[model samples]
Target: MKTDPTYPLFPICAFLGFIISLVPISWHFQAWNAGTCLYMFWVSVACLVQFVDSVVWHGTLNNHAPIWCDIASKIIIGAGVAIPAASLCINRRLYIVTSVKTVSFTVEDRRRAVYIDLAIGAGIPVLVMILHTVVQGHRYDILEDVGCIPVIYNTIPAYPLVFMWPVVIGCVSFVYAGLTLRAFLQRRASINDVLSATTTLNVNRYFRLMLLAFIEMTCTVPLSAYSIYINTSGVTLAPWISWSDTHFDFGRIDKIPSVIWRSDHAFYVSVEMGRWIYPTCAFVFFGLFGFASEARKHYRMVWMFLAPRISLVRLNPRCVQFRIIGTMP
Candidate 1:
């Protein structure tokens, strides 16, 4: 086997991903989970882990970090955040279609929609984790002159590699979501016979689906473009730079001797471009949080709208309203 230094961080990140995915399942059984709510819950876990890991870990670790550790941390962190955005957009599409309908669709149909979306968002990551483990042995190689804990800055090659999966998944999901919403919109005015729903309900579904698609694509395009730029460039910020102040006076020729060496052009380009792209990702992340906030607000509105109409009793008398026959005013 080749001596590669980054093996350790992989297990850590993958384990974190598993934990993130598992929590929603637990919530499902424990929290009386609604289908739409479960998707949001799953997304929250992914986003939290990614946000914490990327910002905290990268801020500390310097170059000479291990390969496996670096890659694992980034992948887990990026996916944690990006996946939730994707899932929410998907959930929005499903909810707008299914929820507003007054038709008596089977429980199985609802469950099928939920599981299919889950598979699209979470299933791919699970498969990738398994494949990575099987192909590469579990242990990660530690980097020289690095702290025991894994960090992203010290780990150079791993940065682009880490975002590879998340970018692919996010872009694909965004495209699918956009197309689905567009199709729905084109059919909007022509939805002649919706399943026993009022005109207001039909209008809500039409508008919400389009809104979800718009949000998903708008947020994802920046992230995907940034990821692709970094990946293609093949350079990373110096892990050492991330840690130490490199601003010491090089003008002191008496105190220090500078040695010139042949530079890798590809590496230089990667570093320069990555600087810009990284911040683009940060912006994408902020946009996603905004999207989630909007979703929470929308969910509350949905519940509020439904509350007056729903009842505990199967055949509540309140479900019907009677009009008095012609009485003298």
Candidate 2:
């Protein structure tokens, strides 16, 4: 099968995104809370997986690394849920800090909030991973350029089992974001006081967090809903069978042909969107926070650390001294 022209771009984009997503986590680590950390972690992991997948199976259905695919398939499932889960934590935290009732939070209250965020951000994804087995139609599907992805039987149960969590989490996050926005509007004059009293956020970081959550919710909810609609509509799904029959369906492994993907416009759109969305999210995140004053400080520190080392390996000593002498004039 001829390779899609866009296939080569996947690995490059994913790899760049992976690198970009790591900047805040590695450099300005202290600026983020558990929720932001979790979100970046999920994005980085997903980008790494996509990078590997694109490199391994670009324009081919060769299962070069089956073991890796097994692990990656599961990671993809968890990552899908974890991202929105993390966003929920962010919005929920904003809601808590902005609530009028939270006049001042003690250390214990802060610890409790962290625990709650961890539970929602990390716990729910684990639960979803376990629940995914019920609707998993087969081992996995190896698609050209996309590598291995879990196969969910488009049965009645799959809707609740696998497809709904992102939308559900997104909707809940929207509610929290709405509440937070209302609180902010009402307390605009004293917003910094409200945040400083309840959390570590200053005006800048607080608004950034809010904007991040809002944008993520707006994108995730509609995309997830549309994904569900496209995957379900205009297709005759296999009848619902017993859990065993659905889970252990015959032909446990399959390689999707590229023609099948290209033939259907909606299917193609969904597939491409799934492939590109994580990198897009990473880029969006970088755009939102990568240039913050704290991030820039980290950037300067990184440059400072690297500059001396780079200067030590002078390609042209004569040119370097000449440049130094030029500065004297």
Candidate 3:
């Protein structure tokens, strides 16, 4: 297997992202809403999977751990859908908070909102995972330094079954984000009152959440669109096919030679983009929320909890040396 100089960077970035994404989840566990938590959870999962996959398969195409690859490949597919779905939940929540006509939200209304967010954030991805079996071309593909990836047949059914959800969810997220922005602009004077009355959002947190949703949608839509175009362009398939033919053709399934991927430019670009997207999102999330006042407080709490123990450990070595010398004398 041929190696690329850049292969090593994938694990490093993915590992960093996995760690950075976990900070908000662990530190601000109670502070973040379900949507934000779900978003970070998917990010963490994707990054961790990439980190492990890259480290194991770096500069090699051998399927050393086929079972791990199988599970990771499914996760890779689910996470691609889950992240955008979570963004939609966040945007939708903001839109509701900003556009509500009622002056106060009831407990049932808050509970209902949480339920909807959870449904969209968690439910849709599970549905997509079930749907993906229809288009899954083969068992999986193991690329040099890229590890195992799901093989989706680029066909008419794959458009709706696999490729379009991210773009579609992203478009919906964009609409919600736009409406939320418009509502925020129109009610800037009373926005704080509305937020305090309706939800746990403060002005800064509200702005950051809105901005994060906007950014994620903006990135997700176009990237997904481009990916679809690249995957489908110049390829001709029957315009219509029977479900049996298009569905996972287990009878004809076989391993693709790893060397073939080395020369497939389009596939390489797609894989490269997929590898970087989660880490980039993680970095962006860290830039946005990693240093906020609440995050800083968590950091201080962690330091305070660890500092005494660390000091005692450091002092114990010297104390041990002194005790040994005294005993010898």
Candidate 4:
């Protein structure tokens, strides 16, 4: 393994991204039980751990972070795989189960949607992981410092890390896409139909946001497939990044430097680069596209909360007070 001076920079930026994402997430924590929000929250957390493990914890420290972070990270890694599928399925169900004449969904339907999404988002991966543990070995290679990779990648009878999950997600996405296209056209059959919906229900916005979420998820599929291919085909696409800060006894040499070193398995490093991309894009889309009013409200709320005293300024001494309209009073 060769050293790259730029490697540390990648994880540093990724860690900062995960940290920044937490702010909006904090604002939305009370919203987890809402439809799609719970799955999205878990997915965000999974991305956070991916960044930490792949980039930040680069030494013996990797082996010794808070235990929950480790456990949560691994479980949600699989949960992330099922998230988009769960989202699309529930969204399509909402569209179908709603009043076609009224063009609106019910809160009761949304609550039920939450349950179905959770089942798909959390259930499939847990079952697969359990099956893997019983059929394969332990998921992580702690003795060799492989971190939290599935043993299915390198075990005998070699189950793929990618195969069934991608197939399932792809199948679900395809069905969702077809159904959504038809729904979109039927609802927008004319400007009257659209304006009628705008005045009465405005349910189209929910569908649009669902479409945006699917688009973002679609973009991540290629990267995911490549990672899977590498593992399944037994190709060492990348090297392992070991926790290099540990002391190694080399018999002849007194000690080995424990700083960051390029190890085997570069697949993880490459995948980590894109790990934050999907969650980041999805979060931004949800904020601006789905929760535009809420985002603006939060922005204004924060601005006023922070700078309520600077609303207007006095330019001159002789009763010359001018109200600052836009910014920087």
Please name the candidate that would achieve the greatest TM-score relative to the true structure.
Answer: 2
Report lDDT per candidate: 0.41, 0.82, 0.80, 0.47
The residue-by-residue lDDT of candidate 4 on 139-254, one tens digit each, is 24221121343333343323344345745575566566666656656656543454354332234445544565466456546655665565556453332233231111211111
List the candidates' TM-scores in order: 0.43, 0.90, 0.88, 0.64
- Give me the runs in candidate 2 sitting further than 4 Å from their true place: 26-32, 101-103, 249-251, 312-329
Q: Residue-wise lDDT of candidate 2 within 2-87, one digit each (tens)?
A: 56767667788999889898788764245337798888888999999999987887778887887888788888888888999999
lDDT of 2 at 95: 85
- Which one wins by TM-score: 2 or 3? 2
User: For candidate 4, which ten residues in a row score worst on lDDT?
Assistant: 245-254
RMSD (Cα, Å) of model 2: 4.0
In candidate 3, how many Å is residue 274 off? 1.1
Which whole-number lDDT from 0 to 100 does residue 106 have in model 3? 69
- Per-residue lDDT of 42-67 in model 1, one digit per residue for the tens? 44444343334343333233333345
RMSD of 1: 15.3
Off by over 4 Å in 4: 4-8, 16-35, 54-56, 59-62, 65-73, 89-99, 104-107, 142-148, 153-162, 190-204, 235-291, 306-329
The stretch of ten residues in a row with the least summed lDDT in candidate 1 is 253-262
Worst 10 residues of 2 by lDDT: 314-323
lDDT of 2 at 41: 86
Question: How big is the positional error of residue 94 in model 3, measured in Å on the Cα after superposition?
Answer: 0.9
Show pairs that collide, candidate 3: none
